[model samples]
Target: MRRDLASNIADVPAIAPAVQSAAADGAAIDTKGFSSLAFLVNTGAIVGSGDFGVKLQESDSSGSGFTDVAADQVDTTAPATLTATSSYKLGYRGNKRFVRLALAKTGGTSIALGAIAVLGHPDHAPVA
Candidate 1:
């Protein structure tokens, strides 16, 4: 995890619940969190299970909200195999501090996410 003092100071008291969702082939996930900061997505798969891909999006509005941030197509051809983890850092250069983070499965028949972690501080410390 990296650090940015300016953004960290702005993220304090602004950290909200991180969200997650999955799709069979074209499903979508949605949730809210602090804006203009970076976030990481930790994902993996189970033994004998199928592989999956993820698509990330964020929004400043509540209703009809969300804009595409990053999208990844994961190949889970071999279960029980150690697949490389997927990660993304979101950065926005606007004043809007409130935004929603959404994840959607763009590919694969079945997929699962271990956890969605948000790091960095709205002050000076990093999220642990």
Candidate 2:
């Protein structure tokens, strides 16, 4: 059995952890060498009341031209309306080569939130 997960999977910084009040558009992640992806959204000490909607955007190219991924391609539908200090895991089953996180903060104070994209099922082991 292989126990070295660090060498077998690749990770990309989807969003930087920080206290933000406005909507955030996370960095784009390329999914070319991977087949599976899971997104982790973390929040700490929300100050106001509003739905911090979370959604996935995709594009053939990582630089520009992005659109919202189909709802069916994502695992969760109601995880968008989050307003507390918690963490959520979202799975992406879409076929898009590039994906990113778009956070919509509606009428909320500065919320500390961050996100990461965990790549799995790489085409080759020991992802680099």
Candidate 3:
């Protein structure tokens, strides 16, 4: 009888599929998931000459609405140049969820944009 009971239990199907379906229906995957999200400012509409600075705001405006994750200083000299390359790694805790890149200019002059790329595991893995 015990042997038969053990075999029956082993044959039982798991309910994992139901749980996974629930997770998919409720929670939305962010960059922490297999895919990542990013934005670029090339038109120079956000920043221009004599601009104090530029703030990269998260498009999602909710509880933690757009926060100033990063900023860049503009160099105000002849042939104004971007003081530094503005790049920021955004994530919660120790995990790097997303990467943001922007340019800062002192004067109204267009600058060549730096190539931005994203790389990571094909599967959803926590940023180490």
What local lDDT does model 1 show for residue 32?
31
Superposition TM-score, candidate 2 onto the true structure? 0.90
Error of 2 at 100 (Å): 0.2
Which candidate do you rate higher for TM-score, 1 or 3?
A: 1
Candidate 1 accuracy as TM-score: 0.41
Per-residue lDDT tens digits of candidate 1, residues 18-126?
A: 2223431111222233333433334444233434443334445545455555433222122332244544444433333333334444434443444332333333334
Give the clashing pairs for model 3.
none
Identify the runs in model 1 with alpha carbons over 4 angstroms from their true place. Answer: 1-21, 24-36, 46-51, 70-95, 115-128
14-127 in candidate 3: lDDT tens per residue? 111110101111111134343333322222222233321222333242233333343232111212233233332222221234322223334543332322223333342333
Q: What is the C-alpha lDDT of each candidate?
A: 0.36, 0.83, 0.27
CA-only RMSD, every prediction: 8.5, 1.8, 18.4
State model 2's lDDT.
0.83
Candidate 2 at residue 8, lDDT? 73
